[model samples]
Target: MSQEITAAQRQHPTRVASKPSSYRPEVQGLRALAVLMVVTYHIWFGRVSGGVDIFLLISAFLLTLSFIRKVEAGRPLALGRYWMHLFKRLLPAVVVVLLAVLAATALFVPRSRWSDILAQTWSSLLYFQNWVLAANSVDYYATDQSVASPLQHFWSLSVQGQVFILWPLLFALAAVIARATRVRFRRIVLLVFGVVFVLSLTFSIHETYTNQAHAYFDTRTRLWEFAFGTLLALAIPYLKLPRPLRIAAGWVGLAAMLSGGFILDVQGQFPGYVALWPLVAAALVIVAGQTGSPIGADRVLTWKPLIRLGDMSYALYLWHWPILVIYLIWRGREEVGLVGGSAIIALSLVLAYLTTKFVERPLRSMAWVDAKKRRSGVVIAVCVALVAVPVAGWQQGLQVQKERAEAEAVQNNPGARVLLDGYEDQSSPESPTLPLLSSLGSEWGTLDGDCSSYDDGPTDPVLAERCVGTDSQDYEKTLLVLGDSHSQQWLGAIQPMAESNEYRVFALMLGACPFGEPNSERRPECNDFNEAALRYAHELKPDAVVAVGTAAHPTEAQDNVVAGLPEAAVDLAGFGIPVVAIRDNPRFGVNMIQCAEANGDRGDDCAFPLSDKLSDSSEMAAIFDSLQGLALVDMTDLICPDGWCSPVVGNVFVYLDDNHLTKSFTASMSGEFDRRFHDAVHW
Candidate 1:
């Protein structure tokens, strides 16, 4: 987190920045620059910098040196005590920032996100936010801006924390191997790190390609950077390059590190082979050491302002992201202008300094904290307690909100059958806010059984295995619903219709995969699942087949499409079963649940325009035109009426997340849906 210490820093053992006696002010300066780059990319560019990679290398590099010194000198590893020392040094600033985020959430962020913020707060405090984010990445439904968990940046810290604890154990093992084999301890350590570097690099390259979103936060995928740092540390003593070459290497390394935001596509190319550029540059700079040449980049790194910034880099990094998040929420916008961004940075630096001065320094300097295990335990307990307060409050609040929502859903929400007798004038709660506006996330209809949602099965909609009968006791006829979650949402509404019509509701649904050609699929598994759903639809030989008729994209005026469709609908019609394709609902990247909370009384202010929001279902409506038994249930008018789509309708939130309707909203729509549906099939 900090730069290498000059003799001056060693005197201040409680200093926030980590210090090794082999002081390199330039490296500290590099740390400052790296943090600045990260902050810049986050605010102005929405890009990632090689700066984090640089920090990752430096942390491991410093730790490796400290461990090697202890091993060679035959000093006690004091593993537990050293670990306590790191915890004391690293945790205070984190706890302070997390508390600040909680405060901001209470003030600025919507209650709709309280659960997520609370969860992420706990994850960040416990140092495992990365895994949480990785799991959310594969969940197609988790995609949206409102779900931007404040503690997301802690993923790097989580990775660093894992390595901090693990790397020492590695050195301990290396010491044992050296003692037993009569080998040089340094050589044993080098061998261990070399194996790690190779294994992790291989995994990183493969996983990055296979699942980049999850891989981005995977600690295993990032291990090579740390291992490479260890290797660099082991090699530094033996690197006997001349002064001129070392100076040249230092400049080249600095430039490469700076090039990350400009030259690299951080998302697509990072934590893989592309990471070698910044990581190797870091190694070069470390090996380069402080050059004697006046022109060396080292001179710039050691500048007083840069060194001071490095001294507070850890705090700066923690505070910047959350501050930016709060600012965005306050402004109710995604990106900020230059002035607003500058204001954010200025405020971040001030807050970072305060955190370093009051929180980190006070706890780290406590005489008992690092000196006694009992006090370290107490300090750790206190930090946990500090975090628990807000997390517990938020969870309790969410539970209360859920309870209130259920109560409201029962009382205020009119049954569609009775309401359809008159013009649609669904009643709204006197003041429907987050608790009611976003109540539907939990209220959304869900179905998952062997036939409805299974890991292994033939998913062809006609097959009995892929199909589940929702109400088999009333099964006078069959109502088969097929396709992805969009189609699945309809189950709540259609279940009633199916029951009333003396039909059993059967659904064969995949998460994001639609019934389409394998080539048009988003993932290979999706393609396979699509084939299964298609086949099951054919096998079930149902009286009716329900599916979403459109595919979507993010581009403006460009969402409508049958780009993902190929042979499913026309071929299904050949079975003489009516294919009821519901027009795909418009999608939004904004978190309407949160948006409604921020906009106050007229939640309609958050409404999305039809031009930008709508996705095309007309493609299938036309393609299925001449195919008998293939009915296009154009419900476009229902989803986005008159070129505008609002999140709330009749006081009920439509989307549970971004695209799919909530179970309650869909359930209420049964009357209208049943009417259109019957008319479409001419039943």
Candidate 2:
């Protein structure tokens, strides 16, 4: 029987091959180093350390090796069982951190932030936080503030979790293909992943160049990083190097990895070709393996302390971000100093150790839980429910409050009406603002109508999609609204007036791109959008064209009309389309709503002098007089009454963030806006 077994093993060398040990102490140490770099850079430097990329590569490398080994051994893939088991181990710490974040948000985060936090909590729990962030990054109205979400760091883990589910299937498919074609499984995997690497890397480079913010979290753009790891795993076993070269490579890789964050702009130019810097460094370290020399990087990486920390690296990564964010909020600091950062790191380490010891390890080692796939699935469901139930309840409660607030606003919030001549302030002082602090997230202006009736829209897809008709199809005349987000917000004012006056209002607008002649300083896309909007306007001549003619500054003494506004107005006048230029509203350096909430909404300390927000004299006067078809309407007196602009005007929140007008406030300005429109256009 022994002789027969030996002969069978000889016939299938892979089945009984003496493979290199799957455990690598140096890799564990590398994990420890990578996570430390991430925490340190985030807390002190406010930069990305490129450590998450290393984690991604290592995860795929280990996963590919394990799956390939199982395939070679002729074992069942059991992908479903693997997924259940893997998430069962991963989710306990994640749940603990999420629940902690929920509690911290309630205690430290402001009411204005609760809605966003609630949404992110669900996204993080479901492992789709990366997609949520990518969508937000590209949202035209998304705030450009520097406030960081406590759950933002989960983007990488979300990406990793998604890949974990898909990568095993890839290996399984390769195994099937190999059997069908009578080829080696490793060669098939190499070919399949090679194509994935090439295609995904090319897409990543192009997308990163085109839209870096969205590309940063896009899974398609990140697949090549995982593919590169799988390819490295397939090639590592066959690679042979001299001892001295191995030693040199190990040291060089370690040095490069340590210096990568300082030398490269990882946050702005990552997941692209530039990402190869840290990836190649990590690959070199993996290639070095166990170079049996004292001076080799493996010697330092094999230290017992680092290996121990690596055991808790996942928990550490999860705990540190929330702690850092909460600390920043609690202290009102943008970045932490050495002492504060040290305390944050220390607290994170303690929490991570506790979580790993009491939560992760015990559940991972539970005998009954490991015995059945059903048991693991039950644990995952339970973990999800633990976070989801309370989050849903909180959201439902907030919805009730928002509805109540909206009803109250309809009854008592007069908004800009109070600034009108002979108006009375009848609202109770106890009544909350039009958009309650809890409901501030929904303050952005939106059209109550669509663009379907307009048959001759702009040919530019972006402009055509944005062209909205906010009135009944049976209209006497058409009014074209054009410019940037400032113009979009004014739709709140235009909609009511159009409905009453029997005018069809079509809004053609883009965020951050005011309608004008293209300039070298502006983004090429925005410039192109401007030119397209102009051409479209000339062709489809409306009765009148409304746009923001001026740009406001936060601190400058004089606000000026945007460059080329006069020229664009003159050009449009030639097409018989009268131009109504609405002077832009005041912009503040700080969040005016947040300030109001913080100061009891009395609008005392939050008020700004009109002198600082607007020019001493009208900058549009000269152009308004010179151009025959151009009419200037300045509502600065209404928005900033008594030469002072307040956060809350007649029980209504005026601005959503620092600049854009709240829809409620603009809606209340309908009467004043109509009077001004008629005075200017005589329509």
Candidate 3:
């Protein structure tokens, strides 16, 4: 939310016939408090503080108040002028912070994160970052060692920006309906927003229950939060309360809002019915507006210092997250301690004050820029270009470098051939690594096409939709690849084998779901997918079923076979199909490609001891001894040769992120994989 409602009011005053316009300092103080909650909870508690919800509510409240007054006074909405003016005020500080983040990312963050940062930069600049993040389906609650994206907090702002455009259209539609039907304007406005609040809240509850990670950033799921604010605005003018009840509500609401982060599991359960706790608390405080009692929450909220801080609340919110994230990355800490956190907050406050003074206030108040609608639009365009032009250029540069490196890899990179006994090193040591760091983000292996294109694909909808298949129309053998992304990554090697052996490959893989019997570890959807895949495999009766049989750990000493692999294998055996289970690859705690980019490619600093990542022998061998038609294939020697796994193997980057093997690296293992597969299946 923009946090410049007072400035907006001053710039465009609406003629109110019934209720005279009045400035609410308590609301500004509330914004200040919400921003502090978000910063402190993020830096120290590592939890959601419900502050963003308050911001969304307050934004809609002020917006509705402005538009409804204009509609009542028979004044033009001037929506085009409003959008340009609003975004002109919002975009300047956003552009500054995004540019700062780009520079910080280059200086402190690893190379692996640059592509994502660049993508998010464009998304943030264009106000669609939330959808981009939802499409990625990242778990916002994850507190792993993986560095947080500096621009991730922009999701809330993106949602607000989207609502700002849509909410005004909603008001315009209500005005049209009132004029056409001769209904009271206030009644039509309430009916429209009330319907939105109900429908959006219902969808929000359902979506959050089903897929919370995606729902957390979904604009549809958050629209109700904004609608609630609009509904409250419509009701507030007629809301009459006794002095005692208003005074009590003021204190009660403030207490509830303060206690929400501590008492609720906000990270795990939010943006659902549970979110009503904070929204209702905020509504109560707003309803308790200007209780004259000295002990009332309004008296505390209207403090002069809080009012001043609220003026810079948007800047503070923008500056705090990147500072906290970069600080944690630089210090190599999970959570900032009290002293460091204090320093971070202090630095953020200073920057926020300076940015508000120098950038936000000046642009909002610039008479020359604000004189004409086109001038405001020009300011918006310039702000977007300042960040987008450089980001796009950097992206193009990386792509060019990656293309050049790929061209040189054909003759220079030997990959797994170098691991074979009696193989001589034919290439010079100066050869560049295959799948260079610039191209590492696109290294995940994928099939030639989905199964829908094949005439002989599975009849089951789940299998047909989820499966990826080879292009071979006629083949001697059919091979089914099943399990999680680990199994899918092996397609780089498997596809080459299929071409040589004339085997048609169809892979049905789900992220994080190993091919196994239903278990507690798998989500309900994953378990259902695994069951569907098994039934499809039985019906197809492929010559052999391929799956990753073991689980690798980043820090564990001994790797083990997946919990239900043997059971799944036995079920497949019942259908007279052979199972060729590949051993899992080594997983590292750090990004290997990033390490290689930081240090020299040949340096030992990027190597991890094999003993830490995997066991010396395959655990699946003994576990599947009694199971008929089951054979184990272990390639740990090639992956982590000489008892130490290095990031680069024979001038090729091995792992894409921490665990997933790069397609180029896997393709290099085709020779060894071909030999092992024939020996396992004997087909």
Candidate 4:
């Protein structure tokens, strides 16, 4: 990639196209409004600005009209000419902004985030950012206080680019279809526009209600905002509002848009029926045209200061987000002091002005005229190379980093591979291994309960006899272990214990089980896992049953699981096999080995204080209290002693990932089992 860039740079000369003097200030003013909305919303409230929504409408209107005009002049909509125009207009500013951000990200973004920036940069340059982000399934409201990427805003720009790519084809198709049908060009365009608008609107509303996150990134769902503007262009010749009415409509529209953008949160229905407010407002404002004077509409929107800001709006928008994000990164917090934030905003404005004046204006004003064909193409190629080079380098860097991480894990802790390849007994008894002292301890003993069942072996008489002798000899002890990946993790720890103890461990487990009663928690998966486990456990009629689960960051609903379980498990308790509740261990933020590699330190040197790692999940405590008469084990003391938790103890590495302990770490905790069992059970 780097070599390709070098070759391209050597072969091409960069050039820029001059914008015609007839270019309107109102457009810049609109740009200013869009930038202002995006910046303010991001810094203060973290939301999508109606400003961008306005821009989308304006872009649709302006570009469609331009294309239609060219087509009417009897010229084919030349793809190369259209693309060259777009490249010259958008790329220079975007390239400059992206380079600045790329540098800033390297200096400030954590290695964890570098890969994301690298991916986004490539996606942004290619105008596929929305799809890339959607594929990653990034939670727009995730609470991680990482610095925001400057290029994060490019998703909208990419959406626009994607629209343009197809819009021309659609426009040409509509023309051809209209010409063949003997219908007017304008009517056909309006008809197509209306159809697209309805589809987009319907999709937006449905997705917003069902899955707003998905709706936000969906291009098809967002098409109506642009189609609305296209429809306006078609209607422009037919509908003319009186000046007073047009002005009134403009102000009312602006107000509605502002209200919706400011008042709406990410949680609310977005880009749906609610989005119509801003889209309609933008349509009205444009329809009012420059002639309509809706009282103070001109004064409010066309003010010199606003116009100046609008002129630099493109540059300002380009610069603001990265600055704010870098500031957040440096400060190690999302909150910027009011004064500091204001200063940053002011700096962004000044930078925007300088960029607009010195960079944008100069470059855009230089007419390549006759040089437009080859020289302009060369410049576009160079810009593409620039974007592609860094992006390729970044992707390669991630691959290297992953390799390094794995190598580090193995080098520093030889058994890391063994830990990750979790063990399960399919044919025979499995060996025990300790989990990390951190969260997800290795305590999964079978609880003999009423619901325990027999496991019949295959047709193999020998294996069937072994199963009957060992597992079904006495259907007196039934046990269940249900939970997240954490619960599945305890299989190695308890399989041996269950066999020796003569109990059938009924594994009613699923990944991410929220150990609770049916219907009490809203998590459907958790409810289902418990429902099946509980039903099966109820049927076994063993002496007593035990249930174990992950207590990692236990929520209120999880607490309900513990509270609700005692009554449900009363049948097993009645048989004298007391219900045993196991308390989970603390969790480290990142995998112990991975964190060590990134920190350039060893696990021994980097272990956090026990208090920091150990979380007292209220849910687990409630469960313990709920089953007071039953045996309960609080494993915190075993995992952390004397206010200290070691990532590596007794020469064993701890966590296999951010949360779950390594098998070796869990194996070491087997001693705790003996101590707890001697006191709790009479085997």
Best by TM-score: 2
lDDT of 2 by residue, 580-661 (tens): 9898899999888877877867748999888887786445577566766678888888788899889888888888888888
Worst 10 residues of 1 by lDDT: 1-10
Poorly placed runs, candidate 1 (over 4 Å): 1-22, 415-419, 422-445, 448-480, 494-512, 518-526, 536-544, 551-566, 573-578, 586-595, 598-625, 634-645, 656-659, 671-683
**Rank ordering of all candidates by lDDT, starting from the highest:** 2, 3, 1, 4
Score candidate 2 by TM-score against the native: 0.96
- The C-alpha stretches of model 4 lying farther than 4 A from their native spots are 1-24, 135-147, 292-296, 357-375, 394-398, 401-405, 408-411, 414-517, 523-548, 552-583, 587-643, 646-683
Task: Give the lDDT of residue 326 in candidate 1.
Answer: 81
Q: Give residue 559's error in model 1 in angstroms.
A: 8.9
lDDT winner between 2 and 4, please give it.
2
The lDDT, on a scale of 0 to 1, for candidate 3 is 0.85
lDDT by residue for model 1 (315-404), tens: 999989998888887777788889999999999999989988888888877885667887887787788888898688768776786677
Q: Indicate which candidate wins on lDDT.
A: 2
Select the stronger candidate by TM-score from 1 and 2. 2
**Poorest 10 consecutive residues of model 4 by lDDT?**
425-434
The TM-scores, one per candidate, come to 0.85, 0.96, 0.93, 0.69
What are the lDDT figures for the candidates, one per model? 0.74, 0.86, 0.85, 0.61
Ranking by TM-score: 2, 3, 1, 4
